[model samples]
Target: MSPQTCTEGFAYDRRARQCIDVDECRTLPDACRGDMRCVNQNGGYLCIPRTYSDTSCILGYTLAEDGTCNDIDECETNSHHCNPTQVCINTAGGYTCSCTEGYWLIGGQCQDIDECRYGYCQQLCANVPGSYSCSCNPGFILNPDSRTCLDVNECEDEPCSHRCFNTYGSFMCNCDEGFELAADGTSCIDLDECSFSEFLCQHRCVNAPGSFSCICPPGYYVYEDGRSCEDINECDTGNNTCTTAQVCFNFQGGYTCLDPLQCHSPYIEVSDNQCMCSAENPACRDKPFTILYRHMDLSSGRSVPADIFQMQATTRYPGAFYIFQIKSGNEGREFYMRQTSNVSATLILARPIKGPREVVLDLEMVTVNNVINFRGSSIIRLTIFVSEHPF
Candidate 1:
């Protein structure tokens, strides 16, 4: 057996019994220098330069002192083929092209990646040239981590007029016990307890800021409970003005001073509180058949259009019809009478009277029957004393 030697780039193959060409590009680590392409020949290899613009050495490469090729940094020399919008990365004997952040290279061109499509933000996302940002929804704020969303405490800014409560990602405004939220939802207003129901007070209802109060009328006071009322006995309290000729009469809500004397002439005394016109006297033609005396006390600033009194006719005859009118003492048109039925009439105060003032009204009711050809009239002397204060 004999061993055969082959030239460089040629190897002896015993199985083939002949010399085979060597693939120097795969076998030798430094076969291709400075990005040069290695080419194999019949008995040798060649280092073909990828670029060749240099006079003494291949482009993107330099001739070292030892006669070997050293890669040249084209990026530092600014000789790379990359455009100004691209980045130049230096390589052995050449340079690579790269785009800035958020851009990708495709077919030697830089394209933008729509990061917003990936849904990086909880509410909104914006994609920039090379980066992306995340944002939160309303009533929320971005956390320090830049990706998490946290609730914004709007209550901290004191946006509510009364009480503010904070919730997850939102806030709410609430009113106090006697207040209500306004249309704007942040401001609070008085609930107006008086307007809600008439039963809120036994006498009168007054509304205040964030609260309400119930007040009693004249001759009465608010009871131990805030809304109920209790009548005051003016006689027992010595709150009456009774002259020596008159006696004090106690009533449910007031006192009366009545004289025990008889009625004046032309007005014959009929009963304890009534007087009649004598038919024999000529003045009786214009006088009412009966006259009655009544008294009432009112608090100042009472609400108007109040039906303060009702008068009922003594006659209940089937053929009777009635006419009612305010005959006298309505100087300012303050009083009017409404005929409620054939036998009943009501006195309405049309105008508000400021006190302390006394009002005396003569309201008359006339009964008529055409079939009987008879007509009779009666009058009520209503004396109303308005107090200076509202109870």
Candidate 2:
């Protein structure tokens, strides 16, 4: 039995000089299942089942009855070491940790995420532990979507009394033409147009509620242009108070009276600004004067024959011309006269006199003869009284 070889699963013992069983499980603890026990047999070994309690499992492993330590799915068994806001993932021997929504895993702990860093809000953003909110500035408001801001309408309430204008975050007041906004900014006040020198008023300016009017002084009237003033012609309108013998001349702001009376051969200038019959001249005494009276019936609206006044003048020189006219006292408009020739005429009352009245007719006669180279004139004044009763 010296140096004899043994078969598989057997060993030779030199002292005993025979084949023996080899307990491979005792030398190699990992030769069988982790939960199984190793037993020696004849030339072989056996793996027997072992028992273990729940505590026998490691932190991330489960214990089996064969006394084996297996990998445990802590994610599925709800036995992970992660926070409530963390996600668990099953690994080979343990579970991996990750942060949930709105949170971040930092330094092995869940921390609040700053959503503002991602521009979550249009204007302003506030971050919480796990969420975020949006807000607006002073003159704006949050939109319904909670992510944007909108401007407010300040003119909706109609702040101005006259006119209101809406701005970005406020309101403004305005006024119409010829008006101005008051100090309160809501009311409107009148603008004094007359106070400005740029106002074009020819004469005077009168201020009103919201406008101005131009005024003209006496003897002047506003022109058709409504701004300038023009001189009024009293002679054309027959509004002058001057007598018929006086001529009316219009000036800038007034009128002038011109006396047309002139003294001739048989007449002299009187202190009353008139031409009178000269007592020293014999032709003045025979000034071709004639007077007659007339009557009328008021009830019948009929008048008697007109009064006749005649004057005849004969010159020895040929080409002698005679002229006849009334000098004054014709403004009453109640009397009329027609001259049949240069020296003969008739005077009549236009209507019946309502009461007793006296009428004076001043007549003048002038003669010019080139043959005799002489010019002569005469004046005749006649007075007539008209009584309401028959007279």
Candidate 3:
């Protein structure tokens, strides 16, 4: 066998001891063009492609292992290669860039958008990158669905001192203590203090809606009870500064001195033009009078017997009525029976009568009814005297 030699030298066994030809096309048929075949002539192989019935991949595309041309996936290597708003899709040997739905794909990247145009929200809807948020108008709250707004509860917080009222998006707080709320929450009103006095200060209290006061009358002190007035005692303690002949009398507001005559009987001293007297005074006396005889209901219509005058009228006519007229010669003495049952009548004279001629009386019966059992006209006699002062 001969050793291999370089080019320009002759006569070497190229097929045996030198490089041999290889049929690369037969081993890698799928990697080469469909019409190309490998030829084995020398140390290297040559390709010869046949004419194809179908079209080949364009310049931007490369043949795949399966003999079909495919595009590259540039997006897989680094998403930053395309605009944030745009999506990269691989095709036969190239990529397609597009903006995401709902986005204008300006420079890439999704931005918050106003959805009010599509009426997506019940009231107002805001569009965000992969989603949307819902909100109600200024006066409302977002509903649980987050797609709509509902009424806010103003009363739940007890916002008002008197009353809490709810309106569109807010609430109102009311004032109750003799006051009212102004358009704004800062101002308040005061009720009339003079009115509703009862609820204010006690004991002659005057109410000024927001306030009140108490007062007392003159000469009287307001008692601890606040409602009552007590008179001051001017005579208490030794303030007996009155004159010896005068006695001091205490009045609600002050005191005064009385004289003897005004003090009447049972009085010791009197001065200052007042009268004071005692039981032993000469003006005190007892005056006496005699009652004249009188009769009534007599059968013969004769004058009553003189003896009727000897006895007192109390026993003779227990339950009968009698009338007596006294002669004026005896101080104008006269008497009349009391018609009412169980009642008594008395004949009193201002002066004492000394003799029988001093007085005379006429007696008579005015009426006789079935209720009376008297057999003869009723008679009555009596003696009387006048008393001083209390008379």
Candidate 4:
């Protein structure tokens, strides 16, 4: 078959079945630069420089090669064309990057590691994104062996002289030669053994501060240290130790014997403390009596005459009588009294006046009226005493 040719200005061969693409720029060698790429299409081949192709152009440039991106090199135009934390890498059709160590790759970027926020371990453990740590257990210390933890033995050495107490991770020793523990458990010192002695008959004994003893006279059995001497129970002591009048009460280092009738509640305590009395021992009795007092007021506009009189009421107790009598005075008044069989007494005034009236009563009751006003501003006074027997 012969080379096929197009119509119009170019000649055509009737016998040829294929048509070859014709190079439009056969004369030019470097037809496309680094920024441009050439592509071939139907009818007539099209030449699009890489600068015009979207796949070869810079990130901000548009596509010119029929909108088809054949390849892309992100690192060329922007260096780190994506995120600063990512490594810019070029690909055949696109560009991408990833975060490096110490940073986690997220959506399209890198994030910091929040080691302290997670509560990483018990006791104490420091966390560093890609690393972590642990702590020593209680009663133990961090051991360099295998870089782990180990226990400490407190009782390994003899720390106390009298008593040895071993606690977790530690131990203590105490002394027994009349010595007691000091404030600290690891040491001991002499105790005051002589202060508690009760016996008054001791002649001589080496009195250690923490203990003491009584030395008895001849013919007397000596009691143990710090205790008083009592006749030893001869029946058990292999000697006749008790007297016929005494009963024995034995205690540490000593004993006591006394006659049964001689024992009594000591009354000495009564003289030292206050005397307490109750209903069973009444201290005093209450007196039977009644209290008496009267209240009175003068009318604002009423005045009593120079001399006026009126009768007043009275009050009586079951076993007593009270009486009121009007006395003579413009301001001062007096009460009169008389004994009667009736519990109550009444007195009538000898003089009477229609104007304001001045009156005084010796009992608790009073009778008032609008016409009985006082011509002079004055108050009525009542004075009375109770008599138990009425005659």
User: Against the true structure, candidate 3 has what lDDT?
Assistant: 0.44
lDDT of 4: 0.40
Measured by TM-score, the strongest candidate is 1
Q: What tens digits encode model 3's per-residue C-alpha lDDT throughout 229-308?
A: 55555556446567767665554434455443333344333443323333355553221111122221111112222122
User: Where is model 2 poorest over a 10-residue stretch in terms of lDDT?
Assistant: 292-301
Clashes of 1: 0
Per-model TM-score on C-alpha atoms: 0.47, 0.41, 0.31, 0.27
Off by over 4 Å in 2: 1-80, 83-102, 124-132, 137-139, 167-172, 181-187, 242-245, 256-391
Q: Write the per-residue lDDT of candidate 1 for residues 86-187, one digit (tens) a residue.
A: 677665556555556576554445676677887777777888876789999889999997877999999999999999999998889999999999999999
Worst 10 residues of 4 by lDDT: 284-293
How far residue 358's Cα lies from its native spot in candidate 1, in Å, is: 19
Which has the greatest lDDT? 1
lDDT by candidate, in order shown = 0.77, 0.64, 0.44, 0.40
Candidate 3's C-alpha runs over 4 A off are 1-55, 58-186, 197-204, 207-209, 221-391
lDDT, residue 264, model 1: 75
Tens-digit per-residue lDDT, 47-98, candidate 4: 5754445445433233556865444444786744567766654543334453
TM-score of 1: 0.47
Candidates sorted on lDDT, descending: 1, 2, 3, 4
